[model samples]
Target: MLYPIFEYFDQVLDIPGTGVFRYISFRAGMAALVSLIITITFGKNIINWIRNKQIGETVRDLGLEGQNEKKGTPTMGGLMIMAGIIIPTLLFANINNIYIILLLITTVWLGGIGFLDDYIKVFRKNKEGLAGRFKIIGQIVIGIVVGATLYFHEGVVVREFTNPVSIEQGMVETPAFKDVKTMKTTIPFMKDNELNYEKIFGFLGDSATPIFYILIVIFIVTAVSNGANITDGIDGLAAGTSAIIGLTIAIFAYISGNAIFSQYLNVFFIPNSGELVIFCAAFVGACVGFLWYNSYPAQVFMGDTGSLMLGGVIAVLSFALRKELLIPVLCGIFVIENASVIIQVSYFKYTKKKYGEGRRVFLMSPLHHHYQKKNIHEAKIVTRFWILGILLAIITLATLKLR
Candidate 1:
């Protein structure tokens, strides 16, 4: 909304300060600051409302440390994050940009699903929350939407360079550019960082490429979303890690969107990728502000309400920039946490089937709980996880030159 006004002022009236909005860095910084103020200032009031409504979390006998103490903590605090992200994006971003529009839709769509789950848990008092199948269905619905959009939308196109440049001196060796349709994504530490999805079905030749690409997109979206949802097991852990990841990706998005940076970095130049920085700015601010209450002895829980959206939004952001393959490294914590559950469950089921009895894998499933089970202190666990997330972010960025 503000973009047009600033653009008009810059393009027509020749306004002095309004032209500042032309720089994505300036706008992103403003977006973060505005979102922070909105979330922090309105935080207490929203908490009070949640308290007044008795919309508190019902902690069961999970046997984890501090489990009983968490009972009755006000939840549904995802509203804070939503407010932080939405307001800034609306104010600082190019509202007409397809990427921004998609992000807004992603925020609202997944937020709706999460809000419904939280609602079922809070208002409906259904301890199980939204049915697992229904949540999965909602996530799949998002995957389809995102995948179809990326495939069909001309605005989501990518520019490919033949004989791509080396990562040395942090720069493309040969630049023969073409607007080619391919299913490539960035992968770290490879001879060629590009991992083409179409290559997966090499046996099928040309016809299998589209199917392969479509399936890969769906798989990535679903997996990334579920990874984020599972990682929400710890307070401040998911939110903080998300902010770190969002910030890192924002850098990538800016570089990718800028033709100069893209050429210097020897990477694909995405025309509209820079617009993602504004969306991610809102994302980072929302996570940090939410942490004000979500930290340690959390005042309010985000529940699935915020977790699902965080994951979905992150997934969509990466897909938009054609950087989805970087997710395993960028979101390593979420990946490990998710993998722990899948491994634990699979092993337990397999052992039970073979031995007629179940077995445990780490003391708990989500990996963070394994530390929690050792009485390692939740705050410490969350902090250490964040440190690892930072390291992963560094590695993800370092790939620009690490090759």
Candidate 2:
């Protein structure tokens, strides 16, 4: 919202400081600062309100150490995160940018779903919260919308480098490039990193290619979203992990949006995607600031509201940068958390059917809980996972040169 007014002041009125707003770096920094200020300043008040209103998390005894201490803690603190992110983005970002528009929509859509789930659990007194099927349906719907919009949006175009002046010098001086819309994504550790989705479904003809691509988009969105939700079991785990992931992607978004950097790095130049840097900045700031209260011996929990939106934002941001294929490596922690749960469930059912007794794997699921079951301190487990997340983020960023 503030972008246009500042732009007008800079361009028409020749305002000196207003010109700084045109820089993505400046705007991104401002967004992060604003997000941090909002989160830290108002977060305590929000927690107090939630507590006074009796909106607390209902903890179940799973026999893990320090498990029962979390009961009755003020929950649904994701509202603070949402406010921090949205308010700053609106003030600092280009609201008309297609990528920004999509991100805003994704935030509100998934946040609403999460808020409803938390409301059901806290207000309606339903431990089950929103039905599992309903959450999946909501995620699927948003995935379809994102995929379809990216596919058809006129603003979404990539500048492909047809000739390189010098691969060693990292230059793409040749003008043999064209900005076009294509269904391609960056694949990690490949000499020619671009993977076109059309080639995967060539046998299905042009008409079916888009459909297949959309289906793939839906699957990725749902998987990453749920992975983040599952990873939120411990304090500071999800928020801290997500902040790392967000910072890495913010770098990718900045480079992808910059023509010079994109050409010099031999990466696809996604026109106008640089605006996402503002959104990503706000995201990282929100997560990190929320950690003030969300850490060990938590003052508040983000509940489904924060987890779902965090995952969805990561998914959409990656998709916008055409780096969706790198999600497995970048989100390794979330992937393992999600896989552990799935494996535990499948194995228990199989064992019950085959041997008439349910067998267990890892004492508990989600991997982090397994450590907790082994008498590991919750704070120690969370810190270790965060270190792992940082390592994964470094590996993800290294892919740019690794190829």
Best by TM-score: 2
Please give, for residues 138-219, the per-residue lDDT of candidate 2 as tens digits. Answer: 9999999999999888888998757653444665455576789888889999989989888889788877877887788889
The per-prediction CA RMSD against the true structure, in angstroms, equals: 3.4, 2.3
Candidate 2 TM-score versus the reference: 0.96
Report every candidate's CA lDDT: 0.86, 0.92
- For candidate 1, the lDDT comes to 0.86
Candidate 2: worst-modelled 10 consecutive residues by lDDT = 165-174
Residue range with the least summed lDDT across 10 consecutive positions in model 1: 163-172
Off by over 4 Å in 2: 161-177
| Candidate 1 per-residue lDDT over residues 214-287, each given as its tens digit | 66766777787778888887679889999999999999999999766786777778877798899999899999
- Deviation from native of the Cα of residue 30 in model 2, angstroms: 0.4
Question: Which number leads on lDDT?
Answer: 2
